[model samples]
Target chain A: MPHRPALTPLVESLPATVPFVGPEAQERSRGRPFRARIGANENGFGPSPRVAAAIAEAAPESWKYCDPENHDLRAALAAQLGVGMENIVVDGGIDILLGVTVRQYVEPGAAVVTSLGAYPTFNYHVAGFGGRLVTVPYDGGDRESLDGLVDAVKREGAPLVYLSNPDNPMGTWWEADDVVRFIDALPETTMLVLDEAYGETAPASALPPLDVTRPNVLRMRTFSKAYALAGLRCGYAIGERETIRAFEKVRNHFGMSRLAQVAALAALHDQAHLADIVTRVAACRDRIAGIAAENGLVALPSATNFVAIDCGGDGDFALKAMEALVADGIFVRKPMAPGLDRCIRVSVGPEAEIALFAEALPPALAAARGG
Target chain B: MPHRPALTPLVESLPATVPFVGPEAQERSRGRPFRARIGANENGFGPSPRVAAAIAEAAPESWKYCDPENHDLRAALAAQLGVGMENIVVDGGIDILLGVTVRQYVEPGAAVVTSLGAYPTFNYHVAGFGGRLVTVPYDGGDRESLDGLVDAVKREGAPLVYLSNPDNPMGTWWEADDVVRFIDALPETTMLVLDEAYGETAPASALPPLDVTRPNVLRMRTFSKAYALAGLRCGYAIGERETIRAFEKVRNHFGMSRLAQVAALAALHDQAHLADIVTRVAACRDRIAGIAAENGLVALPSATNFVAIDCGGDGDFALKAMEALVADGIFVRKPMAPGLDRCIRVSVGPEAEIALFAEALPPALAAARGG
Candidate 1:
């Protein structure tokens, strides 16, 4: 009813939406907190004690802006990954890095490729930049189809392609050899965004060796998953020097939180804590799979910190099951693509939360079946 | 050279440059830390102890992703600002918000306007978005030329104009009445980004009351300045509901750090701490002015955490003086525009750092004077 400023045509064409509804928003709407917060693929095991200490120590110095170059964090990551400092660029998180990557490689109306129902945040970034998405459906195994993605990239001549190894929602992955084959198959001019956000949770064999000399590939890693620092929003892209340098052209130079730098640095230094979390995560995944079996569902084998439990029903049924779980004070997400929509995703967490999910699943399943 | 993936035309056209060379990069290059960290306009007084405690308390919870909606912090800010939740959008910092604002409003090759040497981050965003920047020289008093900005907007038919009250670099401000006049004179179609980053440090009469009714105006504020949480990277924009809603279309939805939310909430709740810091900032400004006077330089009246001291010399002379200070282990920065370039900006800080600058100033000036 009032005069409003005009948004750019590209932005005007986009819809205002959050790619995922956070548990907090659902809790606000429900007027009560969920009993089990095993959703969103966040590591519920929490960050290392050293990271907490670093954050505490860094908190008092909040009056100083973070290093725009992100020098120390980048240096630490470089040493840990056996890459040069020039090969890495630290950002607020993998989500922000995906956005910048889209801006760097995808022009308006240019075709971008991704597996259908892989990661919505990457799709969000692609659409935000006006890149026309060409999605390839996942293979029958619910893994991101490496062959299908390569075919789409070659067919559409897509300039940008996104592949999240040990993928979100389905918790499925391709082996490192297959990934290398896919990379070699892609046109050299087409950039591949190899999202390894869950790399720490996956088996080492699932990850291709770090190769910063490849100009067309950028591997993304985050503190959010296995490092258990999702709240800090720190991640990095490892790539060729020129590819890494391109982020400086458009990134918010002072965008990083100083505590994120401190916390991530501490986390990287604490490999024992990470190994401990990985062991816990593996045990929790087993617990989640056992819970799935008790409810007469099959939990997909996972290389991620979450399991996708096949609901043995249609999308509508899966949606109802997810709703029933939410109503039962449990937070779980489901894939919405045609083939993958029959599964509900539950993130690995501490035993207490896992027990809550175990307690809630049977009734939730019954409600979906009956109602 | 190795083959590289092609960047988009827009990205390829942009250059790789940071808006500011952070002190950390300087330290790395210089092979030592500066004796005084007074550049970048950061608050040297540091954040409240309560904020530190909140960050420490929130540290372990970094396993949970921040509420993408930023519900709690936004609600707290809404209550404090007397606005509805829909009228606010929280961002990483003013720097990130500026980038989003530029993306939402400025189409490629479209004219956008600001003072010649205001915040370089805003200009960086404009360039990143491929917007044509129409620059207006600062008026005689070193304040942003309100009339000059309006005329350029009208002449260029620019869609966006930026004005920082209690502005950066020169540390000059326009009174509320004049600001209101400038707002009223702007074309209804032209969106105004009213940056009030220094509002908490300014005289009460200098800030117009928060009004979320204007769809064409967005008032930006941050915890970075007077709140003493620059490193945490939390800032918010207040505008009409529709204007603010547009930000959701392009923002990195999960970009806000959870600890930043925790720290900002604590900072907002502790108004007494803010008042204490404001008082200390005022005293430090006076101390800086006294130091400038002692050195026969005139300090501009400042409503900010920084003072702009006129070196009473040309731009080249001021550059030499700033370089001399840098070589002397001080990190003070100077405005680089033709007219405003005669002044070097020094942030108000703890007495020791300020004293370091004071100790370095005489010799730096003498070196610039060819003694």
Candidate 2:
């Protein structure tokens, strides 16, 4: 073999695979754009007019680097959450936050626990850091199984656990009381990463209130969902002061973009616009469920901006249906793990795009059945 | 002790220090904003007007996630750099890239080498990843000691080394032939991270040609400097195909901001604007040098967007002068490492900001000397 620099043994063992194939990649391969971009759970309704205005206003200031401390945005988030400024650490996105969190807590060969099919990006980070992932299956109702996770954490004495409220792919969630019970059950040595990316669209009862006193839990939120700023790449982790401070040890201090801070602060200030987006997202989710019923498939109950429709077949059948939708210029996704793989996941978008998904579903279902 | 989640021993051992304190933090502590913001090496001349328009035009698209592949930008970069598309990987910034590179090549207790005080962020990453950093001091002429780096890499059997041309702090550079000789002298097993972030602002003869066939070299450049898009957080690394492919194993695939992509693409397409900014930057460097001479201080020859003005005294005196400048509402910084600490670094900015620095210099010097 030719001489070259050697990658660490752990990095060498990892595969070069992306957690999610972006819609643009599909569009490129298909040689055409998706008529309805409802995949990836992106908010097609867009950000507030105020945020657009903020971007335009801040465009000329692109020469200056961002405030490395992220003081102003973190202060806004703190005031809104009724938490101390020390409780939050902001970064580029939840994905980057997850990676940094893994680096902070997971040692090489340490066992990390999560649901089998939940948030591949977190799993990617765990593997990137050489952590051994122990996955528990979802419960009968398609929610991430709190009991199973607690059992695995105890069984393996795992140091890190990941749970997404109003979970991705399945769009199922546990109520606050049950979630609190789960948190209380975990050993103090185990850290729980509670991802609330979809919290704004979920029921009020579904989210636990901010509890920054706990040293073992970190709740992550983002502007990517109901705030309608997915492309801006801003997210924050709320935890105990010490836990938050640990992030400063490893985070790229200057990584946050200046416009992200500007746009997020503007987004937070425009609560009315966020309220408006939540309303539209709820209506669109209902519309998607209605389309599923009209096509004779059952849509799972969703507390998120996306709904999963049972395809009344198997994982392969669901994949076929998703591929058919893609071929029809409608972008939709599906859960790939066993037991949850019998459904197609569709995100909430504007009425026109949802209408396109509505028009195409029956035919796509037929094509899947034919295959 | 109260029970809590445990950070890895390595993280526990790391200090919670920022590589550089942002000017905003200083302003907040000082209770006033600086009259001139020339400390951080930002291009106050601003990005191309086309980039501003592009940002405004793409604001609504912030609802969509950035294409994780970063395909369009990579293709454009590939074309411009005269390399194949596979040779490039784009990310948020070079800081994030440095962190990822260390994660890939440096294992716990493994040796990494760089010039002392060259770039503290790179050093921060080395420590963050548990690598043992071996420093080579700059040569007597104030350029990074290439001969010293080669000897250290050979002696330590280091897996990674960093070199920045038109270096920060001292703003000193080596000609292309000298850099090429340094590259040729390194062992193939040693990876050299050639940071050419100042490439656009330097003389054409200062940058070596792109060589994608060299597996041991990864050259990084950014839109942050002469392109005047520091706030956008767009940077790319060019390397041999397999070497570039390694980044995919650990990078946050969706971390690139959508507006950054739009603005950077627009900036790259506007070569005329880049030419205009380069001319402005060259003039500003000379203006800064002239101001230094007028104050009876010597300005080092520079090939960057910043110049180093020697205070003709000890490190403490130079630091006092910088502090006085800050107190006078002129933001400036000094190199803190021994031997490099006799000078203050000033970034090229708008003429108005430069004039503020010019006005503040003499009084600041007098205060330092009096003290």
Candidate 3:
């Protein structure tokens, strides 16, 4: 075999793996579509009607590049968050922002800390940048192991740490006070990437106020979850002006698609829709918990778009049940790490989709038991 | 003045700067919109009518994540290019791809080669990745010196080199045979990023046929220009299967927005619209040339969506002329590097906008020349 142009030593050593296989790829392999389409924790209730109108209105003007500065969107987001425009930075999504933040602080082999089975996408980015990851296993309750994370940071002398409030997979959170403690305990030289993706779905007490005076923490939020603009891929980070300005050095200036800005701006204006979606999300979480109870399973209380149903079995059994659901055309996901794998994740969807999940669960559990 | 999170030594050493500012940002500064929006090479002609319909149709469904694999779009692009799906990787745009590509092959302080005054975004990405840039000056006739670039790569022992076919800033290209020679002469370990962003506008003879067998070269293209979906931020890279697959290790998987995918797919299906656009672009180039000649200035031959008009003066005169045009409510940009600074770049817009340029130029030139 001929040796092609070699990737840099770092790239050549890295594996070609992604954090998650999108549900669309799953549907393609199934050669048919999923009935519920609820696995990825996307808002099944969808974005506001007004956001749709804004996107449609801008569709004809898609020939233009988005504003490189994201001026109006940043202005609006900053005003909404009560921060200056210089305090906010926008990108394709929180995923991209995570990558940028990692790039900015962590060098190859630099230690970075996160909870095991937290947000895999953040880990994927740290790995992508060749950062050494120091993971602490979950504390076995709904909350991420805050104490464990801080210990790892101090032990590793890590420059960066990631925390997901109202976190994914387990759907847990640390209250603002505990979160503040975590922030205060960190070394001033260590940056805290607080992933607040589910901030709107989370109770207000779980969220810290948006203050960009601190140089050590970058708070992130997105239009993907409660805002129902997941398909549009808009996210922003709030930090001190100096830290936020560094993103301009490397960000794809024209990366934000014009329609994405339009959709996010419109969604921000329609607070009623967001409030209504938050109410719907809470109700759906309750409905999912009820369904889990009907199947003799325990549903972890959630503050995000998905609930974790503890299958009262091993990871293998949970995996089998999830496979069964997929086979039955009900898409769902599970945390892949050992201890967390005992549970399967189901996103909060509209009633009809949840009804389909309700109908599929008992049979899925039976199949997993080799009935 | 407090000790903040320390950026990586390399990142800290880099200057904070944005490569290009959008017209919208200029408008914000000027406190009024420009009468003619022509600075960036965006297709003001707009996307196909079909693409607009597709975005509109997908607007309400913006709740789902885009396929991380980008399967359908790759399948279509592969079939169109006569290559396997394994040979293609898609990203938000060529801008994002540049960053990924730089990260893939460049570790801190690795040497990279490109022509001076080419695409500054590519340079920004290279610098951000801590690559030592070795830039070859434009050769005689304002052409990117292929010979100079090859020499620089070998001399610097560079791991990566970038070339934009029908190069930006100045729309110049070497024919297919010369490009083939350039490819053949490159070392087995030196990757070539051949950007064909303006491929749709360049003559067929200018583009070499797609061949993914060479590991040293990744050809990049985008929907931003010809497909008229700049706002949607979709672009793709074609190379050897292994080289293309390497991108997965670092790319943000869910970064591609759902509406962006649907829009690009629809645009691809409308070949007639593309052909019409090519014709319209050719006419606009000619019109811009005529406008330049009417003012006794010379317009360079172009193979892209924008025209470069020589102001027949020094760098300062061209800068002043360009600024004067902006003051006159006409949005046009100019090259900034020393040798290339004598020409102003104007994007091709509608005839009405071109007429606005014609009306404003004489006075702008007079003001620039000391009226």
Best by lDDT: 2
lDDT of 1 by residue, A16-105 (tens): 999999999999899999998998888888889999999988899988898988888888888888999999999999999999999999
Task: Point out the worst 10-residue segment of candidate 3 chain A by lDDT.
Answer: A1-10
- If ranked by DockQ, best first, what sequence of candidates would result? 2, 3, 1
Supply the global lDDT for candidate 3. 0.90
Supply candidate 2's per-residue lDDT for B97: 88
Residue B19, model 1, lDDT: 85
Chain B TM-score for all candidates, comma-separated: 0.98, 0.99, 0.98
What is the C-alpha lDDT profile of model 3 across A145-257, one tens digit per residue? Answer: 99999999999999999999988889988889999888889988899999999999999999977767889999999999998888799999999999899887767788898
Instruction: Give the winner by lDDT: 2 or 3.
Output: 2
Q: After superposition, how far is residue B112 of candidate 3 from its true place, in Å?
A: 1.3
- Restricting to chain A, the TM-score for each candidate equals 0.98, 0.99, 0.98
In model 1, which regions exceed 4 Å deviation?
Answer: B1-3
Evaluate residue A296 in candidate 3 and report its C-alpha lDDT on the 0 to 100 scale. 97
What lDDT tens digits, residue by residue, belong to model 2 across residues A274-354?
A: 899889988888898899888888999999999999988989999999999999999988888998999999999999999
Q: Is candidate 1 or candidate 2 better by DockQ?
A: 2
Q: How well does candidate 1 match the true structure in TM-score terms?
A: 0.99
Alpha-carbon lDDT, every model: 0.92, 0.94, 0.90
Off by over 4 Å in 2: none
Clashing pairs in 1: none
iRMS value of model 2?
Answer: 0.8
